[model samples]
Target: MRRIYQLALLIFSIGMLTACGDDDKPTPKPNPPVEEKEPMPDPISEFIWNGLDVYYLWEADVDALQLKSGTEEWKKYLNGYGSEYEELFESLLYIKPDANGSATVDRWSWFIYDWVEQENAFAGISKSFGYEYRLSKYSDSDGVYGYVTYVVPNSPAAEAGVKRGDIFVSVNETDLDVSNYRDLLYGNDSYDLGLADLDVENNIIIPNDNIVTISAIELTENPILLAKTLDINGTKVGYMAYNSFTGTDEFNLALNDSIGRLKNEGATELVLDLRYNGGGSTYTALILASMIDGNHVGEVFNKRKYNDMLQNYYTDKYGESFLEEYFTEKIENWDGEQLASINSLGLSRVFVLTSDWTASASELIINGLRPYMDVVLIGTQTHGKYTFSITVKDFLDNGEVNPKHKYAMQPIVGKSANAEDNTDYGDGFAPDYIREEWDYLGNIKPLGDPEEAFLKAALDVIAGNNPPVEDNMATRSGEQLETIFDSKELKPFGRNMYDDRIDSKFKDLTK
Candidate 1:
């Protein structure tokens, strides 16, 4: 009976324990949990130019874009012209917008492969077959006016029946100021036959209604301009203005011979004015740099980089893909001569005149020369591109040949030590003796202007040597290093492992 009563009491206690907890505190409500969001993909990863694995330039949290379908919003332009564009979509890269709907880019990823040129260069093209023209400063007819006393024979202008006596009148209704004419006609004057009716310049023949203005419309005809060397203050600056770097071998040859002649005739300072040199053949680059750096000829200071992945690329549903077979089939691209030894003109003092149009190899010469010689870089801060690139040749998977390109890129890849050996210029080499920052000095001065200032300043410092603002180099001692001498005498000659074998053998002999 007592056991049964105890069991009943135990059951009551158990029920009380199961039903109750803390009586002092009221029950509190549980807080709701927070949800997490997934991270976005890096746009740079989506961009692969022929498998050129340019990584993420910077980290970013992108904003929403406006698009109808595939989820990408914004515009992309073609990079360069010629084969690379037709095949590799080299013109366009991917991009992500920011918080304010503004498009953003980094070295890793721009909306297109051509972004650097588009944002930086004076002009860019959808197709890049090397051709240049001159905009006439005084154009009355369809021709733009420039000094045409030395047009190359059999050139487009020579074939078109234009001559030295002719002053360019107008080109497609766009009149050129004498200042920017040389590069304008060749660079800024590409016309699409398909877009004839939508002519923005009204320089196209649109049926009969716009006949008067259309009369000035000249198709893609690169004119040959004539020039003769003019003496500049007895220095014989050899003022042959090159409109473009596209090789007219005969023209360049004549120019070179003329320069040599100028040297003989008392042209002490050779001013190779490339302010208008928009760029051309690497073949020509060596010849030109050879003329300038005459002494230490063939010192290969710069080299271009080539990647097979970037050589032949095709776009797929997933993204861009590299062509191994194509790249392997023909590894040899670009002329071999371009990689030859660097040239040291060996000039104690060099004065270079540059402008925005002075680019590519022109910039390369400037940077490499700085480490070895005393140079006074005149003109504006250069185009700031100190690099080189090689042409890429590739084939498709099925052995079909795709369009190719110069595979253009700046590959100086590192800051170069200049000829003078003081410092290295990252983008563009600033002049040792800066006159004034003239991004557009040539525009303000006459045609033969940049050299004028550079020559004046250079002449002042030519026969003299100048010292650096300061010199700082490591001179200390520690476990890694020890002093070689104490007060101009050898200190005890404490031989270590470096000299162990020889030192021990010679110990008895010395003693």
Candidate 2:
């Protein structure tokens, strides 16, 4: 009986072994489906959307973007545009056409694919023909002409002896009419300009025998064109034809040096020629303001107002004092120890020369100084840009700049007002004295010449002509938006409002 039980146990053990062996066989149940990992989300659009939402002055109107900020829906919406970031940015603008069908909103905002290049440009280092000019029609028979304003030192224009008063009768033998002038000058790298001298007596420009061909080249611009002291009615008047307020540490020193020279020369009054200055650094603007009058150091230089949302955000984060910018007397140099005092004129009043080109920081100087002293604007109405912009960029998780792409936006982040909190000159501040570029008969004169219309008008004012007989030129319309458009197309560096001292704060947020 014991032997029989043992045999039964062995048989049971064999059956269990066989069952285990069968489980290890190649007969397969359906393979468990491979688990797929979710794809990583792209952050480009999010970065752009968030940037505009925070810094754009007209952020409230961007309802489409704000609708789905942090959700997958926002990511999906951005991805729908693919990698066309420029298109995505343009769509976010607050735009509406006026009665003239011209889009008027957020015209100053622009995106740059290469931010490094943009930075170098605003610092007054760039490639160009280095000559700026204006296209105008003197008479129907005389035809359109290009008037050279000022040539950059060591530039192609300077090499070709292009002076401030030199005129171009035609480009490449073709008469420069308003219709084709932009195409001729702007769209080409090199062109032949039929040089002409102003026939002052005839009040017309006659073609010179010389035809100079100029090509574009890289140039580091010097903004101070003409700085001299004039003796008018025993009151030493300082005249400076400042092209742009390019605020660099080096540029600030240069500006201080210019003002210092004027001060040293015993200049009681100043005639700031901003006829072709289409705005630049606000830091430089403030420096000029301080140089004009340093007594207002502790007082408010200008008050900056951001969008309602950004304003509240800033006030919450940085206290209420963040909005006000006081006049700074000292400019600390690139080296921490290097410092220089602002060359303050310490005068009661100053005169500013303006044209259709005078805008941004130029207007800031005019508007900012109104409360403290007289800023008698001479020439036509300004370009009417009361808002300023900052350079917005992307970053990596490590706080360094993201190398994935080089994109930046110069969006209108805020509007600035003087100490009085007055910022209502959207149509531009009209000149106290209306002066014309061309005389009644039509002739463009040298910029710093005492006989020039704008400079002469300023000199007349300093000589106690309270209100010189206003010109019918006031009724004549000039290209008000030309400066802004030209900056975008011909010379991109022209449209700048970067403040070295203050703009660093915006950069900190990016980091």
Candidate 3:
């Protein structure tokens, strides 16, 4: 009876322990599966976004650029555009709204598909037929004709016997018109340019049987078109039809040599022809201005204003003096190698021959000299671009170009102000003597001819023979043709005033 009682008590104790353990323990649960997302596939878009965010002139005005990169929202926004990086870039530009509620989009900033081509163009090298022309519409008909403005020496066009002042009415047997001019002439790499002549009395373009077949080949253009001294009514006038401000070592030396030659010939005054000069390097512009007048070597030529971010950074780092570009007495190549002392004319007055095509660095010459001398303009209004751009490439941590893509950007990074703090020439600088080239189209003379309309006007002014600034179209019998386009506008470097110092300025910060 004692053993049975002990066994029952032990069994009851064990059951009590098991029940207590069961009450104390909790049940196990499986963890929810984790989500894995695919990574984004666009580094080009990221590059562009990052480049513009830091360097864009109007970054503050662009809301999309403010989004922190690498975040979910930033990734979403970028991925929404898919592969259309250009659309993404174009959307971020700060375009002001006009009075009519239309957007005055920024026309200066541009995208580059092939940075190699862009760099080549900066050096004044490109695949071209070696001739620039102006397309004009007949006053009475839809027919269009192109007049050769200038031809590159030893180029395909020059080899084919094309000359300045030659007219073309058709391309590849197709008559050029408003709708098909671009497609006909520019569409093909090679085409037969049908020659034409103007009938001033009938106000028509008569096609001729002569045909000049030309092809576009890679060519390097010498920007110094003509540099000569002219004897104008006992006044020794220097005339230079400078077409571009290519800041190459060769170009800089050539320019210095030209100016030295002019000075050697006893040039008392200067008549600078920039009718077709769209623009180029700011450094080259400074060099040219210094050569024109050496008195203000240390004076401020222009001041640059960047976006808020860059403005603050640069100001704090380099001070106000860093933003100012002064008149330099010495010439240097793009690589910062000292070339030579500037050959200054030391003239108190200068006459600039301008047109609607004269812009950027070309315009800079006018504004920079106005503070120091009398700048007399004798053509149509200037192109009116006070802004400048810098080439922004996708650079790796090693300071080399990003190897995955050839894309780049030429963004308007800053606005330039003269010593007077003036940047208000958006409507362009009006000519003191307005002489439209189209008005005397059929009667056009060679560029340096003393009888040429623009050069003659400058000469007349220098000779104290200030001819009346009247429209010559009334004197001519033909109806004044409307200029549809200028071939310079199609160039890769369109009125660009690029600063080569940008890379050096931002190098340390980027690294």
Candidate 4:
């Protein structure tokens, strides 16, 4: 019996071995190794694309910006740009020339190579010589000359004795003209200004022997250039020459103190001089408008209009109140913390001094206050900018700016309108009384001086001395000089109006 069982076991083992060895029997195959994709080479370009796609004011107008995020096509397009991120950015803007070779819109959107420099600029910090000037062409020739408008205290320019009304016809002893003025004045960190005198009678510039050597150094400008109370014919007229709308803590405090002083001095009327203000924080604009007239608290100051996607998203998430900015009774910072109760003037009429450089928040003050008071303008037409932008950067998952690159974008994300829905002032707001400072360069006066051209005009209007039509025109000798450029135009934050609230309100969208 044992021999028979051993024979059966051997036979069964042999059959199993033969079946395992058979070639026709299939063997189990291991799963193929998973493929891995290479990471994106240029994150800066991706950030630019995503940001513009989500926040550009004219997103629908650009075909490339309409691509779905993270799709293969979008990824391909983003990779195609490689290191030419600036070209990609320019290509996506809505200012493309039409068949007639004219740009359609969006002349203010720009890219920042260094966000640190940009943030500093927004806070009124820059590497500057501490002086502002206006460039004008010689009435009789093609040469150009610049006159010092104001000198910042303790700046390099101020240390070098540069003062208001100082004129310069050359930089580093090189004559300035239409072709080389920009390069000569702004191309270097240090330059010697060849002093000159404006001979108004001959409409020519006379070069002087004096030369002022100035260097660019990091400086923070106080936007409150001049604030004083002028008693014009028994009427207390407050004159404030505010240069920019920087909304820093220091700036807010300074503005509060200035207004407090004006209020304490028994000012019944205001003449806001925004001749050199190129625009700044919308929040600052709201605070300033509130300070100008406190009669309407919680009333609509201005309305914001965004692209369709952001509009619908904001509307659905935050309701209508999110789109409108209201006049507040208290001053606050970007975090919504109350800094101080606003020192409001509560006046019903205000006189604004404007120029081609007065724009953005400056214009907002004029337009927003028109419904509540008499906003009489006294200078040239404004710079005609109705849109606002926000700084967009590549942010990591931790809400920190990506340290890999310094690229940032200041894209026009929305348009601003007054409560009456009045916007699109492309030609700018015309002054009720025209007073062109460049036209009277020969007779420029100190900012707060009662005899100054623009301030005098405002005071005259306030004292019921509206000059006749013919008398309002600026008197010039020989050929009339043409204004070529403004010193503020060369600033990195050129004619910018920014909404700082977007950083907190739309944080998720940027992410």
* Candidate 1 local lDDT, 382-460, one digit each (tens): 5554333222223334553233422232211112223334223434555455433221111223334433444344444
Say which prediction, candidate 1 or candidate 4, comes out ahead on lDDT.
Answer: 4
TM-score of each: 0.42, 0.83, 0.89, 0.89
lDDT of 3 by residue, 368-391 (tens): 888899999998889889988899
Candidate 4: RMSD to truth: 6.6
Please provide, for model 4 over 70-117, each residue's C-alpha lDDT reduced to its tens digit, 9 standing for 90 to 100: 776777777777789888898899978878999669989998899899
In candidate 2, what are the lDDT values of residues 1-511, reduced to their tens digit? Answer: 9999999999999988887795676666898999654332366666677778777888787765575555656656676667788777776777745578996677678878998998778777787887886666654443577666667777898898777656677888898776777777777889898988765454546788988889987678888987999898798999998988887888889999999999999999899998878788887898789999877887888888988877886788889888887788888654544568888989778888887778889889988989999888888888788889888778665667779889877778888899999998778889888876544323456667777777888888778776565654322334221221232245575544554444322433421
lDDT: which is higher, 2 or 4? 4
Q: Where is model 3 more than 4 Å wrong at Cα? A: 1-41, 96-105, 474-479, 504-511
Give the local distance difference test score of model 4.
0.86
Q: What lDDT does each candidate get?
A: 0.34, 0.76, 0.86, 0.86
Give the Å error, residue 358, model 2.
1.2
Among all windows of 10 consecutive residues in model 4, the one with the lowest summed lDDT is: 467-476
In model 1, which regions exceed 4 Å deviation?
Answer: 1-236, 247-255, 305-346, 393-400, 403-427, 431-511
Task: RMSD for all candidates, in order, please.
Answer: 20.6, 7.6, 5.0, 6.6
Comparison by TM-score, 1 against 3, better one? 3
